[model samples]
Target chain A: MQEKNANQVRSRNEIFAERTSTKIYLEQASDDNPYIASAAVCHGYGVNEVMAKKSFADVFYLLFRGELPTPDEVQILQQLMIALINPGPRHPATRAAMNAGIGKTDPAHILPIGAALLGGEHQGGGIVDEAMRFLRKQQTTDAATSAAAHLESSTPIPGFGAYYGGIDILANKHAAQLAQLPGAGKALQWGMQMSRALEAQGVGWLMPGVAAAVLSDLGFQPRAGVCLYQLMGAPGVVAHGLEVANKPITAMPFVADEQYFIER
Target chain B: MPEKTFSDQQIIDSLNARRGKIISKTGGWFPGKGVFSHGYSMMDDLVGKKSYFQIVILNATGKMASAEFAHWVEVGYSCLSWPDPRIWCNQIGALAGGVRTSAIAATAMGVLATDSRTYGVYPLKEGVQFIQAALVNHQQGLSAEQIVASVPSRGGKPLIVGYIRPIAKGDERIRAMASIAEGYGFPMGPHLALAMAIERVLQEKYDEGMNVNGYVSAVMADHGFSPDEVYQIFTTLVASGVTACYLDTYHQPLDSFLPLRCDDIEYQGTAKRAVPTAE
Candidate 1:
């Protein structure tokens, strides 16, 4: 009687395990293609591969929030990014690991310590300090006067153009939204003046000064931009992980051949 | 004009009277070391007329560690010492309390030291905030009865407590501290840190015990400091009677034992200072 009962229990356990595994696999298969498609779209935008993942996260945030974040929210996001990027102050365990690894190692091999401890360069930690310097230089004076002084001083102006070329349509629209805010109209005007100055200097091909103006007027630290992108792309990593968990898909023959040559 | 002899009370009163003038001229809350020197000179006159009395120097020093009531024992000692005629001098440093307590402590101690109860020191705003945070934390988990029970009645005189930033010139800490100070509401005019450092060192040296003075003198002699320089440092230490002295060895020039002066200034927000006009 005891043996029969044990067999019945084993059968029930097997059924439960199978059901759980099946559910996970089905979920992974259903979401895997959509995640890839989203990643591909982000890649097309010229975002760095790591940032492409973040950009997808931003899309998720937008979809959830129903609008792009304001400058203040972006600043908060930047702080979060820094926390995500940097390791907590050195732990004794990590130090022990480092000490163990430290026998005549090349300094380049130690770069991972910084990479792991310091978040990616795209996170907005340092940018806030830089933006603050720029804002202070521009404060108190009218936008035109500030622009003129900034130009005279030969200070590098940020947010005056798109990253890759052509207009940054999103940034331009954001600037328009910022113009309606109190005390921001002047900033928008300054942005236009900066654009004209750049054009006069024969860099007319540069994108218009929208992002910088919006950021400054909103008191968004310059670091917020990278932070925003990082957050946007994070979902892509999750998506990729899901896809990888699905049945291992082999590439087409030519794609596999090309990859093999690239590796070589 | 005849040089008037002023007691500690008179000197403190003068400091109080000139507070506005000092701040406006120096662009800071506390007067420079030179101003303190002048006040000390006035103090000499009052001490000359009085019979020699034993003044115990209690140098209070500790990290602004946790907010426990026991943590403030040193602070309470300084406060308790204020009212005693025999314990005429006291110095407080690195205290973690709120702005109000710092102000109250400084004012109370200043009054006790000078025999005047209204002396005030304008510390950087950040320093004030730090003090306030400390006070708030200290007050937490305490009953009203416990607070009243903790009050010490002493030679019930007020003590003057001065806050000093002790970073050397051009050090990043100075800039960071200055920025924090500015955020708290007091901006350091140029060379404020240097002036504060010089004053703090002089004060600390003046307050040392007799044997400690001999030891310090010997150290100075071994280090090649002239007898007069040694004497000056000793007197300064005796006057300050501070428990802890932060010496900025990094940027301060070794040739002279003076703090460094740097040009870096940080404002509260991300703003930079306005461009300086060429001298």
Candidate 2:
């Protein structure tokens, strides 16, 4: 019987870490109490010193990359951050936030609810890692050749693909602009060429693709790229959510009964 | 160049069809009238008339499950509802409770965490897919040993999702669940038979046995559930366990769930240095 085998349910005896580890941030314990932190350091930079001397973009880049960005790097990062600040009112993530707010859900849940939906694969942060990996693997090759190879394939070229069956004009412009930056590297330039190659088929720069190109160039890991994509678009989702929060439930369309067709 | 348009008329038409309308095959509420779910009136036909699990399966799969099957599913849920916080999803709940977030938020987050590649609902789908595919392979004149060999291996062990348990060897839940299945008078169907044969091969060759996931997947497949339907039905499989974890920590002192000291974290990155001026 399987139940007899249950007696063999001994531990695998795997050795886990004695404590969690990180190099990102460190909170120095106070002299008085071991539990209390007296000082905080991010990548060896004193928090107070960073706050006084550095811009938010510089600190933000340092948080992930372990070093402060140069002027060109900071500029591109800041611009990309702004460009992706809001996924827009029509986006599903923003709409999720709006739905939560309009339904009078707890204000704290607004961000989480929207952010969770924003984690989807379609036009969301879910595909950012894949996009970043695609850009990294294909950046050294001919962009046009790589793009042509995927033209007939059913799967998208990851970061480089159509948005809503057409080119995302804003994303294309953002990629073009970022590529010209001094800090811009192979990923962004290759992506622009890939976008041009795909333009004939009405497929080009998606927002995630644009963010992936810049982030890959900036040396952010693919997984970090996913969270960063979500984080960058969060402000817009929260804003749209809060905008409709105080309004009545009627603020958003509920789809009339006649329009609510249940096929089954 | 002029703005490019979607050349696929089908996509445009599909979008246009639902532009201003909410077309649903599932049920919705009608104010002052009735709420419908899969052709049954929610209040009249479901409430107080059917078991909660039956309705849950109906809502998930668009097909009403038998009362016995629903009870079997409910028992399956019990097998998985371990209150141990060491499990990943439950740990999320514990962390949320430690931080004093609302219970709903903790449960929601934990449920979301279960949509993972590791030991959760997603893996359950993979388990079902594996067993169902293995059954097909068996019928096509493949022996159990051959079926086991077909699986991709990592580190010289088969990477079959349902067969091997993590953090333990044999599954105790399989015994408990099997007893319940017997009590419910479920026969050994083809899928379960194939699963057992494959388990024998694994036990003899690899010293690994089937986990509860394998048992449940085979039984569910035998009962005519598609992998996707089983996945949809078990969407909140870990919710109860997550809630239990939340309640355990919620009643405790703030930030007390697994408090770490400053030195507890091993910092392996850059050595301490002065912040450079902005470049």
Candidate 3:
């Protein structure tokens, strides 16, 4: 057994006076039958100690949200996960993962690099997260006015265009699929309203906007929505990273005449 | 019974023994020992039931945190996590993408690259502390210049003076974050006011503006987050951005980014002839 501290109690002020290295505080659970912290709580029982059975997705939700989600919530989580999981090599994070693998770096680093990139404010899940935030703030305003306002401010609209002025087919496809889910009714309707409002200006709803609206309707905050996006996107990133780990980067083809150098 | 002798180990252990809890007691209703998160009422009976945000506050500041303030932290995180890849640290990821570095290596490289005048958590944290300290000085009767100058120099430079990628006018991110802070019911403290004053003072005196770095300092100070705590908590907020840069340019051949041929190297020093014929 580890040695107990001198006194088990102290005033908060006193504790502040002598801040020590971070101590892992395990309350009430003594050395014998020690326990680790978990985020799953269901049916008034500890998931680990009490054997509360749940689906993998439900368990994941519990870990982040601190309670088992309803079946509908589970369905939304699944829908979002399947939709946002992988964008393949063209996406920055996936490409990062592939880049790592091509250089024959360790398998451990691939997904991490990809995931990290995807989480940035502009790229990764961050852009969508920002877009969702923009949408929420504009809840009082109509989509057209809001879109115009965003354009005026020079702030990038979250779910508008994938290319310079183009919509992503896959993203629209996912939105269409999600529109049919149990709780996605009103949210999808609102999303389409925004999409139609923007479409005249050659703008369309991308996955993030649809995701943000749908998740928001499902009661997830924008931050939580981004976390979910990140979670769903990681496996695809890792897969890309793993696939190219054995290959050397130099073996990849190069475009002709792309190698111009100034010799002066 | 064997004769008992005082052992040195026992003596040292007893001498080093503490009389009070080194860490504070939180009656926890949250996750512990991987048993899943317990609700507010549980037989687990740790000490206190706290939200994850509450625990974060406890860990950072040995104080209880209100739900609103904790949410402010979430809002703040959303703000800082969006520096695009073109910025300094994220560029490492871009370079990695261009160079075909390992994903982890690129991320690791980018994470490490955060240590600069531009990126890294410490600058913002330290900048906030500087403002706090400066306000104390200003209140105690010191000129703004004197207060700014009073901040110690590492290699003769004030650590938290100005922004990197120096914004010509001012950083809008500050206003964005400030608006968010105001929405959270956070009032501008003396430190924030002092930072603004100092920015103007410096700008008048040295033509500097209070950019995102100064604004971040103000926000952290407003939240009552000690400079040390800010760094400890949000170290990896934008690590994903770094990884994204690596992925952003993956379509190109290895080292295809800014591809330089043999002649691309401008050999200015000790040009030409190397081999000695006599040898």
Q: Best-fitting candidate, measured by lDDT?
A: 2
Query: Which lDDT tens digits does candidate 3 get at residues B171-278?
Result: 555666666667777777777777776665555554445666676776677667788776666665557777777787766677666554333333222222222222
Q: Model 2 over residues B1-279: C-alpha lDDT tens digits?
A: 215644456666778877998777898988787999999999999999999999999988888888888988888888778899999999999999999899999998999998888888888899899999998889999999999899899879888988878888888878777787788798999999998988888888878889888888999999999999999998999999999999999999998988888888787767677877533
Give the DockQ (2 decimals) of all models.
Answer: 0.01, 0.57, 0.01
Ranking 2 against 3 by DockQ, winner? 2
* C-alpha positional error of residue A149 in candidate 3 after TM-score superposition, expressed in Å: 4.8
- Worst 10-residue lDDT window for candidate 1 chain B reads B54-63
User: Least accurate stretch of 10 residues (summed lDDT) in model 2 chain A?
Assistant: A1-10
Candidate 1 versus the native: TM-score?
0.23
Question: What lDDT score goes with residue A222 in model 2?
Answer: 98
Candidate with best TM-score:
2
Q: Which residue ranges in model 1 land beyond 4 Å of their true spot? A: A1-125, A132-145, A161-185, A200-212, A215-264, B1-279
As for candidate 3, its interface RMSD to one decimal place is 41.2
TM-score, candidate 2, is 0.94
